[model samples]
Target chain A: MSNPVSERGFEPARHAELALLLEVAGTPKPGNVDRRRDLSGLCFEHFLTGAVGSAAGLRLAEDGAPVGEAFETAVAGMSKQGGGNTQFGCLLLLVPLVKAAVAGDLSPEGATRAAEATTVDDAVSFYRAFEHVDVAVGDPPGDASDLDVRRGSEAESALRAEGLTLSDIMELSAERDANAREWTGGFARTFRAAESILNDEGPVTDRVARAFIDLLTEEPDTLVVTNHGEDVARDVMDRAASVSDLDEAETLAEEFVAEGINPGTTADIVCAATFVALERGVPL
Target chain B: MSNPVSERGFEPARHAELALLLEVAGTPKPGNVDRRRDLSGLCFEHFLTGAVGSAAGLRLAEDGAPVGEAFETAVAGMSKQGGGNTQFGCLLLLVPLVKAAVAGDLSPEGATRAAEATTVDDAVSFYRAFEHVDVAVGDPPGDASDLDVRRGSEAESALRAEGLTLSDIMELSAERDANAREWTGGFARTFRAAESILNDEGPVTDRVARAFIDLLTEEPDTLVVTNHGEDVARDVMDRAASVSDLDEAETLAEEFVAEGINPGTTADIVCAATFVALERGVPL
Candidate 1:
């Protein structure tokens, strides 16, 4: 896997997360699902599916089961988040990244091209192909339908039958805030696990982590630019900087792993760092 | 942790594909970096930082370097893929997501609340925060100035300095057709890794592979409701009846794992299915 820890630090939590997910994601013959990580508690997965129906405005039918409302209703279900709506928005962006991988959308050649592309557009496209799309497109923006309360409720219920909840959708309502930035238009994003770690949660501890962290510094620029050294340092720094204060260098390093780091960025960094170390035959 | 292989049978690969990213995101180290992965390539970070610059349009007088234009020109340098341009339209949506993550404008608590929302409208307020910025008061997306492009060929040269070659990037691009559903709007309709896996790739092997296959379906209903053997069987039978197949049961089970399952759907199904299985205490 790519190193998400490169700039931040190694996290066994990442491996733990992957192990946990991988352990459970197999077949029923393999084992039973635990409640803690199951539907009883809302995790990233439940959050996403609910977001999908919510985004699409799927409704219950006149019958006991729910029927889908207008696509607009569905979209409204996704885009018109009022208060606790994020599942759809997040799910919208992330599902496609997973799709990209399954579809062979992500090839070594493809990834390297993405790695080499100088333009943000191409990079964005490269990344886009890898985006989680059901969430991205299942419930598109602009879902406003002139429906009455009863109709909307039915639609909501239908979506619910699919286990699609309204609560997890990303409203993309940021579009309305006058205080928003130009990028606000793109504010609606989803959580597509990258190719290697589908539903791979957080990191735990491992050689990759301990090895990488032993290397960072407060000043990113001052570090040496060897393959593993430099990238690892920057990722560590970014992860370190993401949270509250860590006055000293020692504390900064500790917090990097403890609090963990952003899965996407940190995972990429750490994986690469480990690879570099292995490839270059770094003693550490 | 969810199940890749279900009790019903060997399900096809679903939209669980973050692992594919791991395959291609090779371990490369840029300069002055720390931590690990650098798997996605540092070039992306630079390109993104530059986009942030484009949005912010900040001009910092840094030495004699055209560093301000480093990313800008780099983006401009890429061929427009014979026709398409990434600067406008849907391509622009990511600006908000990336901007929020990098700038920390998207409050964590707000995001969490939104993720848990049931209605799109309900989640709108939380979603709005990423987009909501006070003109002068808000932290504007940082400009190119925030990017640390230096005044030497070394700075720019090092951006993509690695084992990666232009050919590698081109190869990646060509594969787009095999994997991408469309050149535009990528996964417009189906967005599951399982769907993508079956359509473009081929078969499901590992749980991770299965997850990717299932990710493309984009139907939360499948995940939430049909996760159990009964529903899985029924959904397959329904599809089989629609088609001309006889072994609909087996086919349906396999179809479920095909890439293109919705992430939200997959997440929910994995959670729900696993929850039930776990309740039964089935062991791996």
Candidate 2:
């Protein structure tokens, strides 16, 4: 695999940022904040600020800082620049992926190793990160106790009592959270998307759009499910699957914006996929 | 003025990169390669790569390194990511601007102080930077000898014999090169553009687009003149002056792109203006 840092002349943070940028800039990303649409009071510029501001923390992860802490720091910095929840899910996905790339491997195994290395401090930091921004997520399961994100430091204490690692917590939430699913499963779908994106031809944006649509079709977006409901998420997945052309995708995007459906989690996954491909020197 | 580094959470390099981004992303930058057009075998992606890759060197300039070496280093890194001269002019303007911003004033006077503080080695470094990219420029005047950029090191030697600083060389070329004019005259027009951009209320990209058109209309683009002819450059200026809105600007952009008439120098100025606005926390 090509070393994006030395060969491509961009640091891991820059790679993360470029990935975020390309992901958001990919037009006609149906039901997502893209070039043609802004939803949830978030525009393209907020994402731009978030991505660039987050790069510093992502770089720190290479020095063996807790990835979750780095993710929290990145989110905090992003909010300080533009106080919004834009790219929060993308930031969650990218931090670990960047650490994995900086760990000197671009494979799923490498990503898993990076995720596995997270400690209790990372879990604490992960809980603390919630204090910085209002990231949209589904309610904790009815059966679960002491896992509420809104509990903040209290959740951290409970997580400590249970002695569960950040990765363990992610495993518990994987059923409902696409972002958590990637974390617990070592980003299997992200790696697959990277492969598809790398092998596909045409502009980088087009390839990312294709990968995004494919990812959306493969799974109903968790963000849509969280914000709206499972039915809406399922309907969105079907609509994404129906996008056979750019024109149709744009039409779908308009409809998604009109209906207030944002497939933010899938967009987050696509950002991770983009990071993987870029670390391997995907042509933009 | 807002502190971009502290308050905005973006480093000087990121600010430089953002300036390059907003400048290039500004749509309907008539006769220049904006988001909607490509020119001279260069596309928007190449510019994106260059801007991000160039960030490190821009950061170096903030650390009191010679501005010329920073420019060369930035261009060299840019070529590694995307082999082209997509934003050479913008990079030239940004390096000094970044250094000035890092000097703690973030104003035109501060910019001038940084430029004036440059050394003879900086002049040599500036000459060396030209070897990395094929930047569009007019030939030296009839009286100048051994000053041709194609001479590379020989030009540096001649510059040394004359005991001329980088600013001195810029002063000599200021008449024909808009980028040199910024270097020689403390970026007067750029500061003015920044004032206008600051007072204007809209998206940063839109403000940049309007600034670009205004700048192009106010001065005959040196790149257009160098690539085409004075008559053609004048005609382009006339057409740019006729743009009353973004829609009209978009139409003119298409016509200019089709004619291969690029107002690259004006775009470079817009990048400087963007730097000034962003360093002051212009909402984009």
Q: Which runs of model 1 end up more than 4 angstroms from their true locations?
A: A1-121, A127-206, A218-267, A277-284, B1-284
For model 1 chain A, give the 10-residue run with minimal summed lDDT.
Answer: A27-36
lDDT of 2 by residue, B1-284 (tens): 12123245477888887788778777878877766666765776677677777877887887777888898888777765443577778888888888888878878788888788877788888877677666666778877868876566668778888898888888888888988888888799999999889988767778889998899888889998899989998998889888899999989988987888888899889998998888887865
Model 2, position B182, has a per-residue lDDT of: 87
Fnat across every predicted model, in order:
0.00, 0.19
Per-residue lDDT value at B158 in model 2: 83
Q: How good is chain A of candidate 2, measured by TM-score?
A: 0.94
Best by TM-score: 2
Tell me the tens digit of each residue's lDDT in model 2 across A1-284. 12123245477788887887788777778877765566765766666667667767777776667888888888777775443777778888888887877778867888888888888778888887777777787789887657887766678778888887888878888999999999888799999999999999877877888899999999989989999999988998888888897788888888888898888898899989988888887875
Per-candidate TM-score, chain A = 0.22, 0.94
Candidate 1: CAPRI quality band: incorrect
Alpha carbon deviation, residue B22, candidate 2 (Å):
1.8
Worst 10 residues of 2 chain B by lDDT: B1-10
Compose the digit string of candidate 1's lDDT tens values, residues B91-201.
111222122223333233322221222222212221122121110011112542221212222223322443222222212222222111111222222223323333332
lDDT per residue (tens digit) for residues A1-284 in model 1: 11111111111212112222222221110001111122212222322222323322222111111111222232333332121222322222222222222334333332222222222222222222222122211122446321111233334433344332221121232232111111122211111112222222222113333322322223332112221245654665565444332134235434433433222222223333322222222221
